[model samples]
Target: MMSTLAERIQKQDQRALAKAITMVDNDHPDKLSLLSEISGQEKKAHFIGLTGSPGAGKSSLVDRLITHIRNMDKTVAVIAVDPTSPFSGGALLGDRFRMHKHFADPGVFIRSMATRGSLGGLSRSTKDAIRVCDAFGFDYILIETVGVGQSELDIMKVADTTALVLTPNSGDVLQIFKAGIMEIADVFVINKADLPGVQKLKTQLKEFLHIADPKSWQPPIVETISTEHKGIEAFFEACEAHKKFLNETDAGKQKRKEQLTYEVYELMREELWKDVERFIGDDPSKEIALQKENDPYQLAKEWLSEWREKGGGS
Candidate 1:
C-alpha cells in the first residue's frame, strides 16, 4: 500500500499528495517510511515565507501572488498556518476561505494547517508538509505564518526567502528592530500603501535598513495595495532577485547548512524527549502529585544519572 502511494506521489497525483500530507500532519506510524521513500525527490520549488502582524493582509497578498504565479504558467502550493484553539485543539482554518477561488484550478494546491500549540508559528509536521509539496512537483511553495513574532521568525527559518509584510500606521515598522525580525527578513512589503502614513513608514524602514547594513543583499521595500492587486509583480520580482542573490553568494550555502543542522537537532530533541518520557512514565501530573516538595533540579540530575547508568544514550 505504501509503495503504491509512493509511486502515485512520484507521478504528481494530487490525491496521493493529499494523503501523504495527511499522514505527515497526523503523525501516522508510516510517516517516517513514507518521507524516506520520497526523500531527495523534490522538484526544486522556490520556498517562500509570508509573515506579518495580524490584519496586515498576508492571506490576501498570498492569494494575489498565487494568481500571478499561475498566470506565468507555474504550479503553486500554499501552506497557511493558523492559530490553534486551546480548548478544542482545532483551528478556524480561515485561510481556506480567502483562497477558495483557486479551488477549481488544478495547478494551485492549498492546505490549511493549525499551529497545534507549537510556539513557532508552525506545526511539527510543517517541514514535512513542505517536502511533500516540493516532491509533488510544484514550482513554488508559499508558507504563510499566523503572525509576526518570535515563533513566526523561527518558522521563517525554513523559507528560502521571507517577506515581512506591514501596513501604514500599524506600528509594525517600530517592531522591525525588536524581536530579531530585522535580522531575519529578506524583503519588506508595506501593504495598504494607499492609507495615510505610508511614506513615513517607508522612510522609517529605509532608515532602519540603512543602519542595519545588510552587506551582500539589501532587503527591498515594496509598497503593495493587495486588495487592488497592485505591486504584486514588483513583490515577486524582488523575491526572484533575492533568490538569485542567494544562489550566487555564500549566504545561501551557509543558510542551507544551518537549516540542516537545525533539523537534525530538532529531531534529536524530539526523540530524546520521547525516550525520557518513556523512562520516567508519561503522566507528568502524577510525577508532580507524588513529588510536590522535591527540588526540580535535583530530581532532574538524578534522572539523568539513572539514564546514563542504564546506557540510555550514546
Candidate 2:
C-alpha cells in the first residue's frame, strides 16, 4: 500500500501527494516507513525558507515569488506554516485566498500547516512534508514560517536557504540582532520598502552587519515592496545566489550533515516520548499514582525506571 502511494506520488499525482502529507501531519504509525521509501533517492528541489515577525508581508512576497518562479517555467510547492487556531488546533491562516489566482495552475501546490504546539514556527512533521513535496517533483519548495518573533530559527534545520523578511518603521532590526537572527539569516529582505522608514531601516541593518563582521558569505539585503510586486526579481536573485554559494562551498554539505544529525535525534526523542506516554496512559495504576503524587520529578523518574524495567525502551 505504501509503495503504491509512493509510486503515485512519484507520478506527480496531487491526490497522492496530499494523502502522504495528511498521513505525515497526523503522525500515522506507518509514516516513517512511507518517508523512508520515498527518501531512498535524493531530489534537487531547492528548499527556501522565509521567516520573520507577523505583518511582515511574507505571504505577499511568497505570492509574488510564485508568479516569478512560474514565469521561469518551473513548478513550486509552498508550505505556509501558520499559528494554530485557538479553538480548532488547525492552521489559522487562509493563504490560498491570497494566492487564489494560482488555483487553476497545476504546477503550483500550496499547503498551510499549523505549528501544532511546536515552540518553533514549524510543525513537527514539516520536514517530512518537505520531502514529500520533493518526491512529487517540484523545482522549488518555499517554506513560509509562522511569523512568531525570534524562535523561528528552526527553519535553519530544514531549509537549504533561509531568507529573513523585515519591514521598515518597525524597529525590528535591533530586536532581530539581539535575538541572534542576523547571525543565521542567509539573505535579508526589507519588505514593504516603499514605506517612509526604508532608508533608516537599511542604515540600521548596515550598521548592525558591520558590527556583526560575518566570517564568510555576507548576507545580502534586498529591498522589496511585495504589494506592488517590486523587487521580487532581486529578492529571488539574492536567494539564488545564496543557493549557489551553498552549492559551491563546504557550507552546504556541512548544513546537510547537521540537519541529518538533528533529524535523527529529533525522531528518536519523539518516538521515545510517545512510547512513554502510551505506557503511562494505558496503566490505571500509573494514572492513580499521578493523582496521588505531587512531586513531578520523582514521578517522572519512577515512571522511566519502571518503563525500562518492563522492556519499554529495551
Candidate 3:
C-alpha cells in the first residue's frame, strides 16, 4: 500500500501527496513506512526556508515569490507553518488567503501546518512534508515559518537555503541577529525596501557579516518591496546562486546526510520516550511514585533501574 502511494506521488498525484503528508502531520501508524517507501522517489527540489518576525511581510513576500516562480514556468510547493487554532488544534490556514490567486494553478500547491506548541515555530513534520513534496517532483519547496524568536533555528536542520526576511525600520534585523539567526541565513531579504532605513540596515548587515567572516558561503542581502513584486527576481537569483553553490561544493549533500543522521537519533529518542511513558502510565505504583517524588534526579535513576530490570535493556 505504501509503495502504491509512493508511486502515485512519483506520478505527481496531488491527492496522493496530500494524503501522505496528512499521515506525517497526524503521526499515523504507517507514516514511517510510507516515508521509507517514497524516500528514493525524491527529486532535486530546492528547499527554501523563510523566517522572520511577525509583521515583517513574510506572507506577502511568499505570495510574490510564488508568482515569480510560476512566471519562470516552474512548479513550486509552499508549506507555511501557522499558529495552531485553539479549537481545532490545526493550522489557522490564513496565508492561503493572501496567495489565493495561485490556488487555481495546477502546478502550485500550498499547505499550512499548525505549529502545535512547538517552541521552534515549525511543525515537527515539516521536514517530512518537504520530502513528500520532493517526491512529487516540484521544482521548489518553500517553508515559511511562524515567527518565534530564538527557536527559529529549527529551519537550519531542514532547509537547504535559509532566507531570513526582515523589514527596514521594524528592528526585525536586530532581533534576528541577536537570536543567532545570522549564522544560519543563506540569504538576507529586506522586504520593505520602500521604507526608510534600508541603507542603514544594509550597513549593519555588512558590518555583522564582516565580523563573522564566514569562509564558505557569504550571505547576500537583497532589498525588496514585496507588495509591489519588486526585487523578487534578485532574491530568486541569490537563491539560485546558493543552490548552485550547494550542487557544486557537495555542501547540500553533506547537509542532508547530517540531517538524516540527526533524524535517526531523534527518532530513537522519540521512541524511547514513548516506551517510558507507556511503562509509567500502565503501572499505578510508578504513577504514585511520580506524584510523591520531589527529587527528579533520583526518581529518574530509579525509573531507569526499574525499566532495565523489566527487560527494557539490551
The Cα local distance difference test for each model comes to 0.84, 0.87, 0.84
TM-score of each: 0.93, 0.94, 0.93
Q: Which residue ranges in model 3 land beyond 4 Å of their true spot?
A: 1-3, 41-43, 85-88, 93-95, 172-174
| lDDT per residue (tens digit) for residues 107-180 in model 2 | 99998877775755566788899999999999999999866653367898899889989988667677878777
Question: What are the per-model numbers of colliding residue pairs?
Answer: 0, 0, 0
User: Which candidate, 2 or 3, has the higher TM-score?
Assistant: 2
- Candidate 1 least-lDDT 10 residues: 282-291
Give lDDT tens digits, candidate 3, residues 1-314. Answer: 35588789988998999898999989999988988887864457899999887788988888889989999999999999887744666666655787789988989999887777464456558768888998899999998987776336888787889898888877755666777777888999998899999989999889889989666899999988987889999999999999999889978789879878877877787778788888888889987887788999998898888998998833
**Superposition TM-score, candidate 1 onto the true structure:** 0.93
Q: Candidate 2: where are CA atoms >4 Å away?
A: 1-3
Q: How many clashing residue pairs, candidate 3? A: 0
lDDT of 3 at 172: 50
lDDT of model 1, residue 166:
86
Clashing pairs in 2: none
Write down the RMSD of all candidates, one decimal each: 2.2, 2.0, 2.3
- Cα lDDT tens digits for candidate 1, 98-163: 677999999999998877757546766888898888888898999988784754677557899999
Candidate 2 accuracy as lDDT: 0.87
